[model samples]
Target: MGNSPRPGLWALEKSTDYGKSFKPWMYFSDSTHIKDISIGGRCMCNGHADTCDPADPNADSNILYDAGVDEKHQSLDIYGRYEGGGVCQNCQHNTEGINCNKCQPTFYRPSGKRWDEIDVCQQESGRCECRKEFNPPNCDSCAYGYFDYPNCKPCTCNLNGTEGQHCTPTDGICPCKYNYAGQSCEICEDGYYSAQCKNCNCDTSGTEPSICDDVTGQCICKLLHGGTRAGACVRALRVRPRRLDRRQLLGRRQVQLPHQLWRQAVQPPNFDSVKCDRCREQFYNYPACEECNCDPRGVVASFAGCGSVPAGELCQCKDRVQGRICNDCKPLFWNMQEYNPYGCEECRCHLAGTLGGLGACDTRSGQCECKSHVGARTCDQCRDGFYRLQGDNVFGCTRDCDKQSGQCRCHSRVEGRRCDRPIRAHYVPTLHQYQFELEDGVTQSGPVRYRNNEDTFPGYSWKGYVLFSMLQNEVINVVQIPKSSLYRLVLKYMNPLPDNVRATVIITPESVVDIQQK
Candidate 1:
């Protein structure tokens, strides 16, 4: 309508009966501008096409008068901005649409492809294009065991040391196995060793703490220290006795007394009073002087700077110290100190709970060699969930127990925390007696005989008593208490040698409340 070449007339709809009836009114006309227009058909294709067929269903059956139209005027001719619609014939660049602007089947427009480009729609190749270690097709995900897409690489993981084959996607670090660690599970965690990755039980003081040979699990001991646990100074440093050459001993202080001086000499010219000008606390023995350097902390205070022998033989050391300089601790002791009279504290490790059932402990820290499940500085007690520390038991305690209750599994006939004794039976379901035969439980130290005398008439179920000579005087019995409660002890003995015989009764390892009778 804006491009019409001739002027036209137009009118507005007028109604007087409330829009019930209408007629054309208010006529207007324009000569320079198009006031009104009408057309038979028009082309609506975009710039991708230059012609439209009026017979096509997508285009309008309208005809227009323009200076650029052909003489026949059967079809519209325009590059873009066509008003009529029609399917663009022989679409360009494999494109197909009402305006010839979209890609056809089996083809796709590459990202950022311009619509005006001749080859904007590329044909599908039926193949995936992906970077290395990335999944095919869309390439939006990483391949198995690979991560960090667009720059993907194989997962660096140690199959034996990692918990799983894959690693964390973002960082590419695998979850480490027990006692194993690293970004790629390449090394063992601290205080662990070997391909198996076991804990490094290095001595606390004798060896460097929390470190050992990675492959062999051997402890690296401190200076002058070595043992099963590297807990002691294996060799003692002893002072060599000083010896004098015959000529030096004879001529150095020898003097053939002159006849006049010999008559006045009383006690060998008082050799003790002789003193050398160069002699000091550190150097002694005059002509053959040597350094008297002794450890002040481990040696006697008065002998810290001097010794009687040229080689410091008389450097008196404090207790548990035995060296020329008194610098090293004695075996089974550790941590030398000035104020300590014994020079070092003893390694008082519990034999039962310590590693290998040894009393050796760390020299610097004095920490005992503890078993896997033992604790405390002395390693005397079992950790929670265990009990009954026996030296022969490698793990330091019995692990089969109720951790919360400290109760052991029992047999059908036994009932106790330790399952040590037979259960008491109730004959009438109302009364019961908890008793044990002495002959069956008591451990005797000598040849003891068990006999029964029914004529004594103690009870119908009385078993027997043990008899032994006076040489065998001690007996042992082990009992496990069922619960925490007060208990009474009773003892019986026979006095065959009746000279107003007196007997003493004793119980071992007194508990919270202790009592004895004689």
Candidate 2:
């Protein structure tokens, strides 16, 4: 307070309740300044309500008086300036204590300062450049995916192909999507599958070109589908390609007409060669050249040239090869050319009898040249004492019969000078000199022997009693036939006596030897 209209006085604490209520905080005088009222003291002045007066709170503090002013005597001469509470002098409205060392509201002390600097607080950016999370206002704590100090750095999640605005808080790592590999999800590896990157299924043995389609992973079909659809000659139908034709226009060099040249289906793009491939009429397209349908042995020759070669002018065959297609044999097989299926049978030439082992039979006559005694178209016959069982040219003769002499030739199974002896035991009369034993130790002493039932052998057994009817000396002269000649034995059995004996005689095959019994 500086001026006043009346003479009055100001008071200090003058607490109404000992020291509780600090009210009536006005000057006791008139015309007081808020600054002086804020400072409590015994300040007094003189003047009417309309005249001059020290109306400030400081008018109560007499210790704060001017030396030339006095309130009660209305004099200019005042005294008593020495006092204890002078620090609040000229204190601003915002200040509190005896000293004006503090600032007003909305202001604070700046942290970290020297003692010389006033401790008064000041207005700031509402932040000390902190809080990366907040935007323009006060800098509070940082947001989720951001780290703050002075700079608001976005969380870069290690570039591992992660998505979204916020990366993992702990490590800044991110998750990747499907089928995408590498750090940035930038690459699709392998091949395209289901619209996604996948591995290829390439055949190890039959992979063609590069084995796989670099994009879709569907097997790549290079070439004009000429090879297998999958590059292998499997049984499935192949994927056909658009064929290029002459009329399609390319100056005409090659062709792939269906059956024209079945042998060379893949024609040369240039037709300047001296020769052009052509298949026979019977030939069909099977990737490679196939042989004619006619019999190879009968088809003497063939011509091929897009059917330009007349059928009538086909390769001519000899008369021997007779047929519409020259696929037949002519003349008798024995005398004709060596042909297959329509040719002659092999000549049955006996080793010793046929043309002195030359085996050169008469082809014209189909006659086999035989030895002296052997008589047959094949020269494989034998005499009475010998026989030819069956014939096989691989062996020396027909079975065991000698071809030249028409005689029995011993096989390994039998033994004898003439192969007439059965080494095991003769069960038949087939041998010249072999016996069938009816029983062992067979005599007239047993009833079984007398009844002809000693034991029936494989063949008939002989057991008989002999008797001589002549009572006088009958010395019969008999001739013994030699082994060199053929012979037979004749026997006669009759009455049985103790002294008299019956004899059976052996004679030549002509019955020349005589016999006498007594």
Candidate 3:
């Protein structure tokens, strides 16, 4: 019998003649007086189940235990007399309680859903519903472990060596760690050693060959030198090695003997050497070993270590100077003796007119390199036939231009300093003629023919040049005046007639004037 109460209507019947006829003897109703009997006399299945069955004694009672919950339910059976069962089946609305009264584990009944409806429960679709370390909406991909599709076999990765907790799903390979290598980032890379993977830091000069022990990170020091980092060679003196400071061990290959050792090694019995206070000429101040002073304008500031007085080592000089003192100018510079602030003046040869176009020139005379055809003192101007002096051109100019003014000759319709554009025709917007031409109002009468010659005529001449022959030929032109104003007219002509022959000109309408030409 099940531990929980059973839910069913109960009635007693007496049978006679061995399963033939039966008579009703007792019926337990809602008002019946029974001890510990619950009201309603039915299973508590909410609205999902319509009926309930009695407990089967041979059945596994563990199936009735929902997640280990065994709370008693209200029913019509007597308490503690017999275990009542409310085992419900044929659940609806996606509910899956033992009594068919609750939503399935993977689904939920949304707010405002009716109990009997088939869609009362819905599956959770949000990615946040997945496991904490799982990936994707369905949680099918594994992170920080090997993949098995919706499941994972966890494998640890080195936090210091790997960029993230995630590993390659196929091979479970973690990324390389800082200064570490291998599939799982388990060991240090070359030149580094130990669990912490520190650099060897071997001394480059004091050690025979700068390499350290792979495990201990210890360097091999040369003779007269010692220490993990390979200390400098020490000089023989009365003072013990322990007196030398750690700072005295590092730096350049050669250093002056320590002051303690100098005094012990060279001081006389009278101790007069103790009075010596001045630094040697090679240094500005001794003991501290300060470098010699150099002219800032002449030498590179970063390399100002000038050697001894009579020229021992040449200090690095600025762009256009030389000599140990950096006082002299280079071959390409001039006027160094004047003590110019910038050392010397660079000969700025014009690149266009320079022989090799490289700005090479004479240093002493300040003469710039010049091409054979470039004769100017500065080599900036082009010769007689060339124009448009430019740096990119081979001869510093394009040829074929007017020799006197260096102006290029262009076609009649083209106009520009370089003859690269077309001349636009002029238009009078207020004029009555729809399309006006140069010969618009001119009338050529009797043996006169029209001709056009743009090259032979001046640019402002109308319709180019026109010719007329014979004495009876005549040309008449009409003019329109937009406003009253003083005007001048000039006519140019070429006639084959004798020099003594006379020609008559006439102007009429609105103050006409006539003149005779011979």
Candidate 4:
């Protein structure tokens, strides 16, 4: 039954053919006595009341409120299918859906809990309350481990080296330690001088070692010591009573010598000198003092030694000097020679086109990185539009010419540096038409042509320049076109050039083009 016409009256209705033919069920009620069902709407229930265990209000044992529940939309009963009517009144706690059997999110039954009283994962004050560390989305894992969950474990890490979010429980390997580097925190940093890289014991003494082990604090002797430490040198014993052995007659000259020295010179351990740092240059005791091979002007001198040290000393290069021997100066800086008045002077760079305008050149090869309108080492030669004059400045080109500008500057008869205007012409995107006065006072204009042989030759004009040219190649008009489009070039020569003359037609370098001639 849905609703009655009278304000507070209703009747039970029945449908004979799937709600087509209806009749009353013989019962009626006031709107206040029972829930009012709409004339055509299905019945539905309100929220389920918590009544499974009234003695324990907080305890979970709730069931659905089934009075007005829609059987078609919700479960029928507590132990029946889950999709017939609304949950019954006094439904169980932590139970959802129509039947009240499904567990709520983050809630699971403990070993001893009843079926209606499933336990919540995180409980507080006898209610399903999630802890701050773990979200309800997933109770399996947590960060900054302080407590363990059923799905997650507690983290283990040393606070000094790692703590909180830095801990990796899966790999069990600390990302990095306080002072140590590498996988296991075993090696020192690149400036492996000391523990904190604060102190360097190398070269502290007269013959101080140049390098040392970072961890062991041991001196690494230079190669001159035969890759050995200072302690590797052996001690020698002195012998007395020298005598000559088996002297040969050399023009009756007396060459007698000590017997001990004569036998030792030809026997085992024929030594010449002992390894001593104090005997070397600085005269101060050192770890390893090898003999000095340093040039007076190319090395630093401050300490002395009596032990074995490196013979190969580091050299300080002189001004404008290159190489360990200081034989040559660097590029762009001259005043070469072994000894020059000007130390190493930077090359004088001029404003105007100095050959290729390369500031300086290589000292050895005299090669320069060329610039615009300039090339060659000296930068004293003009590339184009520059006349070669007797006196050349740093720019090299003394007089401007037609090379760069293409403005011919030769005699009227020739009109171009290479006599190319009247007899020969060059084609470029900028040039559109060229008219010349003939001998008989008649003007003969070059052919009008389009660049890249565009489709506009018949009716179209590129920037107002026609595509038809009287003399082929006379007026070259190069242009910029998209690469993907086809290159269509149609040449119609209205006048033929004399056998002796030829025009220069140039296209962009490295461009691939095709001619679609009609």
Candidate 5:
């Protein structure tokens, strides 16, 4: 009923037409049926149908082809033809199939190449394994105190012991230590010595041996003359002396004896004497004769030599004219007025005339100038009709008389240049006429007259001595007389004699006449 089957594997209609059609292939239970139906004896019903050839089963064939077959199925039947089943399954390049298990020289694999594989990559060495002359690891770094070399070796020594490599030490190069001397410790000369060889003797002459072997001790000596030598003595030529005299050197035997020396040589006594150049003055001995003796009234002790005295010499006054030998005042004299020894006594004079001009009384001539209105040789007191005023030296006269009136210009109470009068009570007299006698034997009279019932009289009452004999029980009153009256003043007093009274009197200066009343 169905069309006879094709050979090899049956193809779906879609596979035969490259999937363009949809007819499905048939499958049979026996190959006899397929061979009887198709011209090829091969059957198409079995899976080996692809191995069957249409021409001949025994003929060489390109079995890989099937029209419209899938690419995956193309190689599916070739497994038995190659050495390994699949393309690489049992080939030499197949890692699992071969016994070649080692990895390539330069290549490495962390996982095993085979069941017991070994890793083949090289391991790195650490920095410590590098050489000293070069830097670690790669030999690229240089060591301490060295520099890198072109060949990778480090440059070793610093040159000339200076800055570069290969350096060496030289002479005259080291610094000297404290207290040491020498170009190179040559023998220690005069002052110096020691180990770093520095030290000195430091003596006055610089000739002394070093005390502490020139190292430890310093020079010590007397000031100025001192040095390292402890007890060194200075020469006598350095001493200085003050005085030089042959007479002063009695004990020294250095000089030859003089001719007069042996004659009086037992013991030349030391003489201490002073001589006077003028009559009684004296001087201390010999060469530097300085001091002198002076007289009681002389002044030579102050002056040094005879030549120092002035010419026309005398033991004179210490000052100009003061002392004895013309040294003191002559006779009854005083030295009041002038200065110095030349001063002489003063002359006596009145205070008013001399106080401003001459100072004191003149002892040489006892004369003095009289003050105005005063007339004594010494001018010690005031004259008649004048009086001494307030001060000791001042004087004044009674006021002048007024000739026309015969009355004083000033009343008796006022007695100076000015007529300023003192006031007092008026006097009244009982008698018509009265005679008055003064103690000094002077007398005056006046007619007792009345002026306004009060008797007016001359005001000449002064205190002095008056001698008058009074008659028993007869009281008498004496009063002043005015200059205008014509009565004669009596030197004696006579009372009207309640019967007859008479008294006798004597007046002075031998001039004023007495009036005898009847």
Candidate 6:
């Protein structure tokens, strides 16, 4: 066929006869008579052509030369001899091809083209396989008490008598260094004990017995009770005696004793020490009798015959007197002169002005003369700011003033026997009327003005003494005292002046005359 269409770019051509049918076709070299079609640019067969020039033989050969195609794929032939399907290198079924499926069974594949070597699969056993010591089977590492090599290994005992595989056991059974006891060697030497053999008994007088090791002769003592010597028992001393009962002895009736005369059969006579007729139960001796003094303040009475005495024998005090003989006067009442039978004949204070004095009452004076405010025989007076109002009664004096006018007014606001406080302002007469004269000889009758806004006085401010009668409407002028310039304020009235008069005057410092007149 037209020198066999160039290899890779081959196409079937129509036959010369119109009735002929086509066949599955590929290209072959015309002179060599060999099929030369490539699949993926790989050469299918090895054959040479006669008409192909040596320099550029089979210019369109099936062998691809493009760098984009793989070196292995450049020689692959589509219609060449067939090779059986190959398996992946990673799989058990894989024989001779690149492992296209790189993962083992139950594993995922890795990204990349298949290669000759295969990759291992990840574990999918579903059970944990790590080997920790305390961890269960297949654990990757050993737990705390166990060490791990390829497999888990347990700890070995530290020494003999140690049972646990672990280095530390619940009870450290190894014996203590020396002189120690108990499972952990917590106690020490025989009777003495502690974490170590550090203490011993030293107290010798205590109640408990001390101990010593049988072999070493070292002192050991019981807890809290210790002694210096070994096996020495200490006893406690100083015990108190029980109380004795005495109630039964006091309840006995009259006790009697028998007198023993000389008898044919001689025998020792029993004698009772507590048989006394006069002294009763308390007195043990019989020869002397003691009297019981019932008075708490008196001395006990004892005699040769009586066992006890009653309270009547003690001396008593009379009205104003006290003591064993009832001779001294009572506290507040003092005695001045000597007196008998009646004790202090007249109870009195030390001073003349107080109560009863040394002698009888002063019938002439009626009562003792007390100093101004003082009372009684002592001359005691009322406290400061106080005065006596009634006769000799010290309780009557008061600090109040008399109620009537013209009396020394205790206070302008108060008007009573006792100036306890101010009287109501509304009750006092705030204004008063009078006659007065002026400096220019003018006269007037008016009310005088008081500093308290409520009080007023009607009068003038000139020369002369003006006499105004409160009862009769009379105003008369009298001689004025030159020194008392205020006399000028009196007045000679013009219009039968009103009953009350009031006036206002201004005085300057330089106007000595005006001020004096006011």
**Top TM-score: which candidate number?**
1
Q: Pick the candidate with the highest lDDT.
A: 1
Q: What's the true lDDT of residue 420 in model 4?
A: 61
lDDT of 6 by residue, 236-265 (tens): 223232443333121011112233222122
Higher-ranked by TM-score: 4 or 5:
4
Models ranked on lDDT: 1, 3, 4, 2, 6, 5
Model 4 worst lDDT window (10 residues): 262-271
What would the per-residue lDDT of candidate 5 be over residues 1-518, giving only the tens digit for each residue?
37976565444333566767676565434344444322222112112122333334333342322332332322232332212211111112212211222233433333223423232222211113445555432455554434435344333332222222221122222222334333432334334443223344355453323333343233432223433432211112222334433443222112233332321111111223222222322432333333343333334235344445554343434432333233333222334233333344433345453323332332335444344655464555557655442224534232245436545466565543455445466343434366453432322343222222112223334333233333222223444445434544444332323866454432222225644333
Q: Per model, how many backbone clashes are there? A: 13, 27, 3, 57, 40, 52
Give one digit per residue, the lDDT tens place, for model 1 in 177-285: 8788887787887666666677767764776554555554556555566544422212222333355334322111122322312222221111222233344445565
TM-score of each: 0.24, 0.16, 0.19, 0.21, 0.16, 0.15
Candidates in order have lDDT scores of 0.61, 0.40, 0.54, 0.41, 0.35, 0.36
Among residues 3 or more apart in sequence or in different chains, the pairs in candidate 3 whose N, CA or C atoms overlap within 3 Å are 6-84, 6-85, 161-177
Candidate 5 RMSD to the real structure: 65.2
Total clashing pairs in model 3: 3
Score candidate 1 by TM-score against the native: 0.24
Where does candidate 2 have its weakest 10-residue lDDT segment? 43-52
> Candidate 4: where is the Cα deviation over 4 Å?
1-318, 322-325, 328-331, 342-345, 349-358, 365-367, 384-413, 420-518
Winner on lDDT (3 vs 6): 3
